[model samples]
Target chain A: MTDEPRAWQVVLEAIERDLLDGRLRPGDHLPGERALSADLGVGRSSVREALRVLEVLGLIRTSTGSGPNSGAIIVALPGGGMSALMRLQVAATGFAVEDVVKTRLVLESAVAADLAGASPRPSLAASVSLLDAMESELSAAEFLALDAEFHLTLADASGNQVITATMAGLRSSIESYARLGAASVPSWPDTAARLMREHRGIINAIESGDSASAGAAVHSHIAGYYAETNFPTHRLDDMPA
Target chain B: MTDEPRAWQVVLEAIERDLLDGRLRPGDHLPGERALSADLGVGRSSVREALRVLEVLGLIRTSTGSGPNSGAIIVALPGGGMSALMRLQVAATGFAVEDVVKTRLVLESAVAADLAGASPRPSLAASVSLLDAMESELSAAEFLALDAEFHLTLADASGNQVITATMAGLRSSIESYARLGAASVPSWPDTAARLMREHRGIINAIESGDSASAGAAVHSHIAGYYAETNFPTHRLDDMPA
Candidate 1:
């Protein structure tokens, strides 16, 4: 006779297969833990554990409310899951930070190249709006928020939603470090000015449908910042002051 | 005074910080559901809901035993996670299957280019071994398995684990369809022979440090598969019966 499989694995497989089969769309609500356990012939505890794994992937949202539908609602992929996993791998010595940086540069450059060839000029209205917001910002935090919006806009204009989402996740995962890096600059104004200049150049290239130039501009922009700081990639312990 | 934060968000942040800070690691066990709920100051059910999200991410594995170490364990990222996510997006109309194929071609071509560099020469041996394995495979399943290994080996030889892992994930995700497609060709031996020839060509390029040819060969190998099938490119729901 076959030894019964673990209850949690059964629960995990059920949900996973549903996801793979397209039965569970993002935003779909899952049954309550007790109900799921009962239906699957598993313990409630096992059901709970399976759900935890899915959350790490940013696939669903969980909440408590006094109703039948109050449980895990399938969430859109979060902006942090990919980078969180990447960061974990980096921390675990599976890869190097430099390698990650290089990967990012390559992927982002590819995105820029795509943007350049886009039939309609890349729409930077959102990016421009964020740039406008940044122009008036005085504090580091204020500027950093706008800075994120600008980069995300660039990713979006590339017209690759999957890549844009992944890039956004990567950028946001290291966002605190980025802000700290910006703050550490002796000449904050100068650093911001440099970023603004690069942003302007990128916007110009996108507007002119210059794919190669846009890709090169993004490469230089990233490389220049790292060079300025001597590429001060931080460890997980090095959170903002 | 600020109200208590959402339990699920609290659970999500706790897990994120734990993973990032090295408090929890892949393969490390988490406390039992009852204990975790008490420690985190939430009801047991809220804890379960949080767990659901994590499971979708391929992050944790859980089991039953009353002992302290017998509970949820953080696991290595599963190969299925990326594929499942991509499948959903493809199903959701976020990207076409042809877009996925083109993206794969772009990524693999880059990997082939990297393998052409001398510094990464030692890594190419794995791909060569996989090619040998494919030559001896007798069954479709065995052939598919070796084919998967060969592609993954190519990724590793390219010297970027991130890209390798990503490509391996995407390839494995669509693998069943790929195997079916391969089975459909009336001239199976001819198709296998063609693949062997392309593999040899790629191996020769890597051996000779010819980056351009290696990249071009891989591109042609993938694109040629579609052309041989008389399908211009990948399309949704287009898998062979």
Candidate 2:
């Protein structure tokens, strides 16, 4: 435990400090690899390795070649990295399906209540637009994808980056299960229709500024679907919302 | 876009599938680097890289040299990876301090309510022990660390792995900010005394099965601490909880 932190970790923490201290912001270019190596007194290879990790974490984008955009640029796309972390963690068996669904219930219900309660409420225009798209004739896969987006859209509208990112990741990590469960529903059309209606019900509750109902609507909307699915080991019945 | 998946990605996905499918339970050792490289038709270096990513993500622990306990072993410890990912993200400016606090409130309050509501209550013994640990004379840092653990122990008692890991990540990410805020707290002893009282209050509420009060207690407990802090920007005043 007393061992010196590795060279790459040193580079990572230095860059992190720079980011935290506002030396790096979105669209800013990092000092070149050679310059970073010299400045930090680490091998160039260590700099490259840290940059790769940063890129994978969606903090920066690295481009190859000698053009003006060749070096790593801070993009700070939090959603993608969070989504990947969640998706991979679920795939690696670290998160159970029941826990994911339960966590989603906690977040989405809060978002619904918050969004509805906001002064001059934030735009649900994106969500409204997506609901329109869901009405179009599409494959089951496409509809489910949009369904996931509608819930995510509400989270996005809340403008809380942590909730939005976590909701997106949780929704997506279970997407494959959603896709699989689609086949088991008695009638895809009926199920899809019911979900679309529930989506509007949630929107109505939020739009009306009924905070409590908005929360309840989101809760029942999620739980109702889980009740209908063949999700194997997890059941939302034990949970009221 | 049609480029073949990278060899390392293929190896990573294969291992993830093995874990998801129950072939790679915790304590199982991954195949040797040479064998995995040959089996997956990727170079040994690519296999090593994928293994390195897995180790960093806390899905496995890698040990050097020849022994039964050596090589990469599946640890599947979710909290460490989630904590590292979240801490890095927060440092990189992907998560606002305000958002982290709000997210923690959402998850922690839900855990409080749920634990109080459970018919056959899960053990609060761990949290009880942590609160006792907090009563000891210690540095502000040590007290705050134990404070963080007390909250985490409640989430753990909830038995929701996702919530537990996410709360651990969120709490640890803001730790430095917490330490920094300690200086402006006016009287450390008074603040620590209040926090200890609130800790007992939360435990008392949960034990008494007052789910609503349990939730409120947690919300106020957190909001009260933040209210005292001279945290540059962000406040809990905007949202009630």
Candidate 3:
């Protein structure tokens, strides 16, 4: 296997398979590089290369030194790292901005509905306060930052780490385009006011335990803003009208 | 910057910032290692490490040989690589399986609804054929391959690459657990028959252009399968009942 094409990939897959089988897990220290290479019958260089990929993917952390923590240890999925990768992918690949907005509508609406349906409904106090903060005088940049925080809070309220992480990952890409779109709004104050109203409506629906309304409010809030900016509203039409 | 902690990270962020600002894009070739090192004031090794990270993230592909394509060229996001990383992450981190299911319900339901609303409705003929093929006798692994293809087709039909990529990435992890859960079903034949029926129902709803019913059917089909399998169904309760 070491002599085969992409020898490092073989080592990566071996580790990945072990992970999938639950043989390795978070906090489990990987064997030392020399030992791993010997066990897998691959060169130490191959083992090191494979570990580099895993580390970049947030699967493991390596510490330097002769201490107990020197070797690689499996780690929790690094949400921030995943988000950074996603933001970069979205930026470099030029995935259609409209498609991202549509995707957000689907995910955010579901998140809002999920939060609304939770038995002991998650508190929207943090989210609502963001809305309140928005009502005061602020620059578009400041308002957009809070706006993102509000949506991220809603995603967190869904209690699904995957959803939360994904939303956080896409936020920067979404915000970049949103900031561009914000520049086109006829009136910043009016646009901000409308956004605030929509935010309040979404919060109220979630607080009142109205799942359908909560979903609808989220969908409308996102779609309305894009439509107002005249930024290719065609995709929004496919969503609930 | 070279003396800073994680200097390679500085190189990575510099390129990422350029990508985000639209200074870099798909199909563009990155500067050679020497030039990047000089421009970023980092060592060539740091530049190489940063490039390797970007390559693993599917943001670029490097070709060897002193030809036109020898350098790292920005590439479209590689869905398969992302999927592999996600599967490994889910396995190593023990991200709650139930959280994955709930996230699926949110995503798949939205995809079904979106397909139903497409103006020149995306064809479900391929999807319908997969359902037809599943009716014949097959092993669990065979059935699962078809099942994944079916969901992926629906995701593709929604016309959002991001959602499609995300669904594709989650499919393997979901399939691993779903296969395990399948073992506990009271009657395999009964469960398979019910799944087939639900697939047809979802297809019919989409074909008839009833977005709401299509979404509802997909939601129920997934939630129902988990419920019947006696797999931890606690998370389903948080979704809209």
Candidate 4:
């Protein structure tokens, strides 16, 4: 015989089913602990536990005061939840650093090409500004951080939350990889200048509606850095046709 | 003034840094709880808490009785960790249904094309068998179950652990989406037959080493189902080059 689900899991699943069925939605308030416990036939503690996990997962926001916003409100912000999951998984060493970068190459390249080809291209205004900010004198760490933001800005323009979230999740690994390359680099200034140029090249390619060049530019920008850094890249010759 | 770090987070980060530095590797036993607390200057309970989280994330294994094998040992089995994170995120309604499928289309299509172009093609014996099994007499539910597995089988055969995990993580949504389509269709047999044929078309194209056609076939198969089912698909024409 199958084992019964845990009490908190029962509460969690019930809430999830409701959300899936449109019985609950973003911006809706969850029932209070006592009422949920009674309705779901679980203890108040189980309800609380599920709620705490939900809040931590960025599904709901809870405030302590008895004001109108005191209770848990569904916000459905998936990006933060995705980021936390990926961060913890990375910290746990569950993901290999190499796989993280490979995934990024696939997603970010797709995002750039998608941006380049859209009939009415989403504004690269934010991305352009981030690049402008990159030209300022900054530490290797700061420039790489802005570089990470620039890539995320492109993913954001794609308006695909899944790709955006996945890119956001892998942000740290991408930065860490580039930083390792920077560390071994002979001169931070030279590497930074080259990186800024490559970044500008990518933006220019996209803005000119050159999807092939935009995608290839991103692939080369990332793969080129790793190649120079002595990282064993997944053979780029075999990238998606 | 800066607040002190959470005790458990300090322990977690310390372990993570060691993992990043190649100090703690998969299958290496973690220091005993007492030793870890002493080394990190955290309470014993904090050490235990961090270990508990790590175990839950599938990064470690712990057992009781204080035997030689009872200590926590690193296990970098990331699939479960990725799956759990995604499942919880989906449960929280943190990911949109459309974005999830859109991601699947992108990843699975790329995976199929990658498989097509590999010099030493990874075995598709597993995938072939799954497809053969699908042709047998089965209800829509059983056929759909096999269908989901077939997609994952292709992803697994790609040899990219991240794509494999992401596909595995998205399995439920894929199945749920298909089941919805199957339920609403006027004839399950007609749809199933068409789906089976499309599945065969994808495999054949890959086996023939037609990377472009292999990729296009997959994109069409997925986008087609969503189209026939009245799902609002992200435009397939804009798929990655």
Total backbone collisions for each predicted model: 19, 0, 0, 0
The TM-score, computed over Cα atoms with residue i paired to residue i, of candidate 1 is: 0.80
Q: What does candidate 4's lDDT look like per residue over B111-191, in tens digits?
A: 998899997988999999999999999998999889888998998888777778778777664456667778888888999
- lDDT-superior candidate, 1 or 2: 2
In every candidate, what fraction of the native interface contacts is reproduced? 0.19, 0.53, 0.55, 0.36
Worst 10 residues of 3 chain B by lDDT: B232-241
Task: After the best TM-score superposition of candidate 2, give how far the Cα of residue A7 lies from its true spot, in angstroms.
Answer: 3.2
Q: Sort the candidates on lDDT, descending order.
A: 2, 3, 4, 1
Highest DockQ model number: 2
lDDT of 1 by residue, B95-169 (tens): 445655656777777677767866747556677778887887467667768877887788776566667766765
Per-residue accuracy of model 2 over B159-234 as CA lDDT, tens digit each:
9999999999898888888998887899999999999999999999999999999999999999889889867553
Error of 1 at B156 (Å): 1.9
**Considering TM-score, where higher is better, how would the candidates rank from best to worst?**
2, 3, 4, 1
Cα error of candidate 1 at position B166, Å? 2.0
What is the lDDT, from 0 to 100, of the residue A42 in candidate 1?
87
Q: Note the DockQ of each predicted structure.
A: 0.29, 0.40, 0.39, 0.29
Q: In terms of TM-score, which candidate is stronger, 2 or 4?
A: 2
Question: Which has the greatest lDDT?
Answer: 2
Query: Could you tell me the TM-score of chain A in candidate 4?
Result: 0.87
Model 3 C-alpha lDDT per residue in residues B1-241, reported as the tens digit of each score: 5565676788888988777656777888899989999998888867776777777777889887887879999886857555756776677754567777788888999999888887899988889889989999987778878988998889888778888877777777666677877887877888888889999999999988999999999999989988887775222223232
Number of backbone clashes in candidate 4: 0
Query: Which stretches of model 1 miss by more than 4 angstroms?
Result: A1-3, A19-35, A61-84, A87-95, A120-122, A232-241, B1-3, B6-12, B18-39, B42-96, B118-122, B184-186, B226-241
